[model samples]
Target: MNGVENNLDIKTYDIPTDSDPVHDNPIISNILLSRGIVDRKQADLGLASLSHYDTLPDIKKAVKIISLAIEHNKNILIIGDYDADGATSTSVAVMGLQRLGAKNVRWLIPARLTMGYGLNNNLLEQIYQKKPNLIITVDNGISATETCQTLSEEGIEVIITDHHLPPETLPNATAIVNPKLAENEFALSNLSGVGVMFYVLIALRAYLSEQKILTQKINLADLLSLVAIGTLADLVPMDKNNRILVHNGLLKIKNQQCPMGVLQICQIANINPADINSVDIGFKIAPNINAAGRIHQMDVAVECLISSNYETCNKKAHELKKLNNQRKITSSKMKDEAESQLIGIKKILNSHHDLFGICLYDESWHEGIIGIIAGKICEQMNLPVIIFTNSYDDNILRGSARSTHKINLKNMLDNFYQIHKDKILKYGGHAMAAGLSIKKDFLTEFSLLFNQECGKLLKNKSLKKEILTDGQLNPVNRNPIFVRNLQEVMPWGMGLAEPVFYDDFIVLSYKILQNKFTKMFIKDKNGSSTWNVIYFGGVIDTKKGDEITIVYKLSINNFYNKPDVQLIVQNYTLK
Candidate 1:
């Protein structure tokens, strides 16, 4: 490692780096240091100002089209994708339109199974019937060249706000607001669909202000929380720009004044308003919202995000929770079946054990849950896994890909696309995860080609699975006062991981709690206070009097309204 030690010895390890003394006041510095942002400048950049949210590279072209739409009172319809980024982008379009004083702004999100991904002909018909003057796309239009052309033929202008890689042929929309476009000079090219849409709204707001059309009272910053939600939920890398958006959004959420609907969803999920971190949005809220669109209509989810009335918000929140529960049950059944089927494939199992990838397909598997199953398999085996499902409809197949430490799945897929472009229908995603479709008959050939393609990409086996610890913790920093303070400063995600600490400790007492959890009380030799630790999964290997190094995260466990700070063990190694 460049700046830090890679050894696992806890006593000899000091956190690889120290927090900046002057700018990163001790507490903030500790948090930054925990995340590997030890430099003062890096911390400042992460906590950058809203002023940095400027005109995107395509602002002038996109703004020109949007200004024309507003001037002519165009009937605009936004076509969005089905995931968190899509939903958030849809909400942004709807809310931003209302804020811009535009009427007849509607959104259409295709069902994951029926209409398929991206802008399809079926959704085009629905939008065309409304006789929209313009059809804008959020999170999906970059790859829909044919669909955009069809809309253009119907005398409708198209403005695309997406963050996916452009295929060989670009969509002939009025303008594209994507940071990845070759024409784009935007500093952050990895903006999510919602982030791209928010940039358009930023440009729109600038246009409206320049036109002196501030007939309505609105602060664009009020929507930062929503942008943050969409960006984080989509799992975009928390680069400098995204970090600013998330940081500001967390500030809004901390103030307890985010979207009433989102607030209601959080309350229903039992997520404390104060402790709403990136994981909460990604794991808890995004899934619920996506569940609605996956198996049913997205109108309910959209309504949940836009509803201002507490009763409606609460009602939708409960409905979304029910839908999410149902989704979990359905997905669990599907996952179990998929895993069992994979077990039956002796050749596949043996291949997976020896190779760096796993690809399994069963015609009976449900498409909605294959992605989840693929992700689970990836984490379990530490290899890239792709799970495929044959859809009920003719000649359609969908699959999800998840990767481990060594491979960037998206980049690898890009290479695969270049080779098998004719076989692929549409595909776009990030480094760790991706979704793609192909004809059912080509399933065997595609799998062979995919493996051949990945063979060249994932050849290394020495990518060690090492946990990077933030070194020793300050004894004074783990008490009630400091731990409580840390809780309020959360909602951390990708670029900002929560604080983790490690130390050599002697296990004092150990007990099994509720069978599934291991509870421990331990102390180190440095006079550090005794700590309570909880471990999920199987039994711990250590016994009382056994010395081990513990890697854990500090958390304030709320028990019956009593606030107690505790350590949650992630991993342990025998001394």
Candidate 2:
């Protein structure tokens, strides 16, 4: 509101003048009050405050199946997806099963390039070759009805632990454990796949303890590091339950109680494990592990997560980092290509009048990176977006869709599937994001259908690119101490967003970094207070001596045990 419009809109929360909680830091108090949190005790992110695992529906059934398997030492196989959540879930299940007395436990993930999502025929055939007695699917299998049925008919007990929303017709597995199935029946509905798997392990431990079959005990907290990484990485709502898990897990990693690989990855990224925060997990650690899944096999990540050896974990960490480097390069190319396509779309925007959603595809785009591309474009466009690319099957294209609060992308895809049941190959996901496959020739038709469905969902709504901030920062608080204090206070994610402040500043100097980002030195307009700022988005239209309003989140640059406050620009208005 204070600078030139670059399609930027700013809204600020009304900070309380006098109702600050006396015990907490003032900055944290401001954030809490802004989120309507009056009682600090309500945000108890301690392990003891977690909701009881018994509240989840079908837990009894799932726990019984797993308990029976562990008692008999039956061959158990973990089927996981190819994401950070899936890797952590598989690691937790495999290690937890063995800890609980299961003798034979193994794990595998569906290769994104060779075997798309969920339990396809190829994945099923691969599973048959393993000849496991029971199969536990984590982060997937909620929508694999036919596969689950097929597995059931073959007498292989299947226990599905997922957090994704279920379809209209639920899968007929031996026991399906998903929070969405309960429809808010309990408070733990927002758990991630790894969280759900950890819950099963907790329930199994309880059952064993009750039945007097317990041999040795393990601190489930030992597994909390993996749970924390998976939960935060999944970008699920940072509800109190999840925050509790993360808070505990962060404690484990901070105290070096976690597996060697988790800490090694963090260190490799130059993050101090002792002072790690939410960003370290979401941005640095989790992404490296996810790289293996995106550019290579997630088995590399799972092995690291489940291992305790220092040297083995260190070697795996470097491999994951290498894969992440490759993914970043490929992703940048795909993103640039997608943006070029959008530029062309805008050229035809006048004829289209207004677009409610976006659908784009290119044969050159990598199938594994399409989801990230879709999410990035959705944020930039402020509308639901679906990105497609060549898939493993000839004549078929794989599409990943991301949606804003204006529309339910998953529901839209489900509707499209219902209407063109004969056209779609496969489809599944949650409310905000999902994936599907279709004939390459139907790309144009699918694009039109996607736009129509999104428009219908957003009947009278107009797209508005808005950023909410926590007012402006006081000059006195602009230092590394403030940044450190904010990071140490609480975790931030979907529900509790990281702190963002908007302020007007005059550019003292500017330079371009990596030929894309704009590195600037600016001083506050009112006060002479100055700090280094970096706009990682792109080159700006502003210049030296120009006064502009910018929204930014506070960051810290820690080098050799020394830290300095850094402003990472979110959006800026040029004057």
Candidate 3:
């Protein structure tokens, strides 16, 4: 069911009047300039070096602490979150430390079902049992002020490397390395948790080399594949620095220079590592790895990342794939339930227009899959959504929030907290996504307040689904060579979105594929070319001879050794 009506609008970019090196094709030039790329130099910024690592806040301090720990042969335990970014960061820290000749390096990931997130008091007890002299947290711990203080008071040094936005009161850790802490805007926006950890390792390597402490040679570049996967999967904006990291990592994957586990994951996903792109990592590899953290235990994913044996990695990859399949099944059922609940809520509220946000709860819903369900509901409804389920604690309900780009979810939650301070137990996250917990008793009030806040925040804002298009496709440039060249230039994610163009087409014929996808032949209204288009996940309502305005991205469908030009339909409207 559609929650909010959407208005379709095509955007046009201003032509650059400066003497810039433009693309040979005007379509490509417009796409690049629309994304704020003015010239070839700006486009080439993805080739920037990792030297910017030195500029990150507290990098040197983190390196010093890690080096001292390694030299002293102290037991170092890494605390990581359960998501893919945390998994990759854990793997990078464990492997990087071992390669640097650290005698003992172990990692602990909080089970999403049990210990909850970050370095909580409960998780601290688990870490205390390990008797670690130092604690290195990756991908989390930025908000654990009390936990950090407790660890410090216990004489355990802590290094926090996280990418999440920090709170007002900083944790008293030995060193905190986060790009968001950078003074400049450029450094503050891009790096993911894995990127932060990678920088720490880079600084550590440099420090070790300068001190002549390195016993064996280690190439940090070998870990770029993991970095790439984590960065893409984390959904961070693909700024220049992030692009450079992803580009290099994709190259490593293409050259078969990544870890055995990564290669095995690619194999299990039916992807050729040599031909994989950022999209493959996000849609295929990341989800499989993330499934372990969500449905089972994160250690399975961490083990898969750190394993050096191809057989062992392949085995773990299979396990992860199974978990992912289970996760999908669970998420699908939850989505159906949530949609039904939403319809009920709409009736109760009396008007669909009143629903600026949706809050749903189900005791039977799997808490691990609620976030995915929330995201799916948010996308389908075109409204901010929060899905709640039973938490480990009987008295508390855990919820995950997903919102449109216009809404700052974390900030919204913060505003709610200001009014209903006693209701929300705890919450954290970024602009588009967040997680929270509240007393079960307050769920009703909290839900009402949440909806009201969303209404007040989004007053007068249209809830229409906006399909941003790069003007219209030039029929002359719609060919295999043009699409191939576009794909070769760069990877796309977050801020650097994949180019989507819209144009009128005459539907020639259509056939249902596998009862799920729709395969159609459509001729451009502007040209005589007949293009094959595939619409996945859903089918269009139009039939043969229907003229429709279609939004799609140019794609190459490689079957066997032959590559054919195909349009992957994003959205369409009857003309």
Candidate 4:
């Protein structure tokens, strides 16, 4: 591929000359077609209905079991995880059940620092105190086989609604509702934990309507706003099904039909709900909700989602904001320390040219922020990274792993477990991210073995970083209308990425903002027109009158209530 070298030693690939779809503006069509949206039919499919919800394995059974619980008025407790997905799933379950006329519904979430993950014996002891007649696990419980048995033995029927990969032996719950257990179709399998619970609620609503047990009309669309937030926050792949769900959910949020809590969160984040998009949810809103789980307790996030009182929701939103700010400071410190240690490790391994993975451990690192640190390091170095810190139990070190291109973190961990089963106590996650724990004494050995396996797996894979560009934007195409067309596409995330284009420009002037952000103005090669650009977390060392090549995404900046087109720089090469 033709490439341009950037100051960071990264290469930018030249835009491809692929066939494009027919649209009013060829620029938009080219961008869409480059992402595999070949025709109008495919574009329409992005907003298609989620018709495969009923085909999910065991969904009907789960609905039947939940309907019976509601009809019998049995006390039901929803067990949720501490992440955003878990918090939203808990809110969806509790609120949806109450709407279905269930009077004794309650919820519980495990504290990461104290209770750890999943429904274990310790959590079961706490659940026993509640003495509920039935238990519904959302976003978690797939791995809690013994916990399921304990609940069953206690005469509490268990309904498991999760999306995590199940183990060899399944839990003997009353009904297991998980998309991973269904056929491998994207629509059937890529549902997040909250997405799964939303489907269960859909089936339950239909069953209630069919059985003539409905006291009042319940529209499931009202809950799509929550599903959208949870789905975006979880970082799941945005397949057609997910895109549809998010598209519909965005409509609710844009129309101000979302819960008061969601509105409050948007307000605290300084994002106008009516103009929000997937990026806002992923960056601004999701972080605050996740912060409640990471720094404090997820109960604050759940309460923020389920509370109807505006004042209470606003108070919780502010609390989450505070926690998020604190989390940022902690994460920044951990990242600096990790980077420093990484430099030392590189010095030690200078003789090892085939190193493919990195493992770092420090008792001082906060367990709650290791994941974020690992992700940032992995992105910066383009290597698989596993960071460990002491768990509540000093004998074991809990770690979070993040992967780069062509590396499957889950598979790598599984292979490591196969060879050194005793070293790794437990591991679980998807291809790009995972979590595990190991004996503190085996850290050195485990690190060596992990790098060896990763090196073997990535021997032939390219490690060079490449910035892909859609194409050069024509002078006439750089306008607010183009930005509006981009927003019309609705949802964009994991699978369907936002568009980035590359072009050469003359640097007119630039100013530093907050010592971290760069605000600049650039003109076309002929200096006919200029565009405003903002680069976050990036520094430009070049001066005015210098020519440069930049890859950027089209964006809209609303200042003083007037929207103007702007470029958000991704990478740049000075000439």
Candidate 1: C-alpha RMSD after superposition: 4.9
lDDT string, candidate 3, 330-409, tens digits: 88788778878988987887665588878899999998899998887887666899999988888899999999987899
**What's the CA error at residue 154 for candidate 3, in Å?**
2.3
Task: List ranges where model 2 is wrong by over 4 Å.
Answer: 1-5, 14-23, 348-356, 414-425, 448-462
TM-score, cand. 3 vs. native: 0.93
Off by over 4 Å in 4: 1-23, 45-48, 349-355, 512-515, 525-528
All candidates' lDDT scores? 0.73, 0.85, 0.84, 0.84
Residue 253's lDDT within candidate 4 is 89
- Looking at model 4, residue 1 earns an lDDT score of 8
**Can you list the residue pairs that collide in candidate 1?**
277-491
TM-score of decoy 4: 0.92
If both were scored by TM-score, which would come out higher, candidate 1 or candidate 2? 2
* Each candidate: RMSD: 4.9, 2.8, 2.5, 3.2
Better of 1 and 4 by TM-score: 4
lDDT of 4 by residue, 1-575 (tens): 01233534344333246555545576677666666666665566343456556787888888888888888888999999999999999999999999987999998898898898867777877898888998999999888898898888888899899998888899989989988886565565888899999988988988899999996789768689999999988888887678888888888888989788999999999999888888888889899999988999999999998999999999999999999999998987787688788888777776656668999999988888899998888876778999999998899999999997678888778777888898799888878899999999999988888898888988887777566667677877778777777876747787777877788899899998855568889998765789998977446776799898888888888888888889898777788
TM-score, candidate 1, is 0.84
In candidate 2, how many Å is residue 193 off?
Answer: 0.7
Give stretches of model 3 more than 4 Å off.
2-6, 13-15, 22-24, 45-48, 186-189, 347-353, 511-517, 537-539
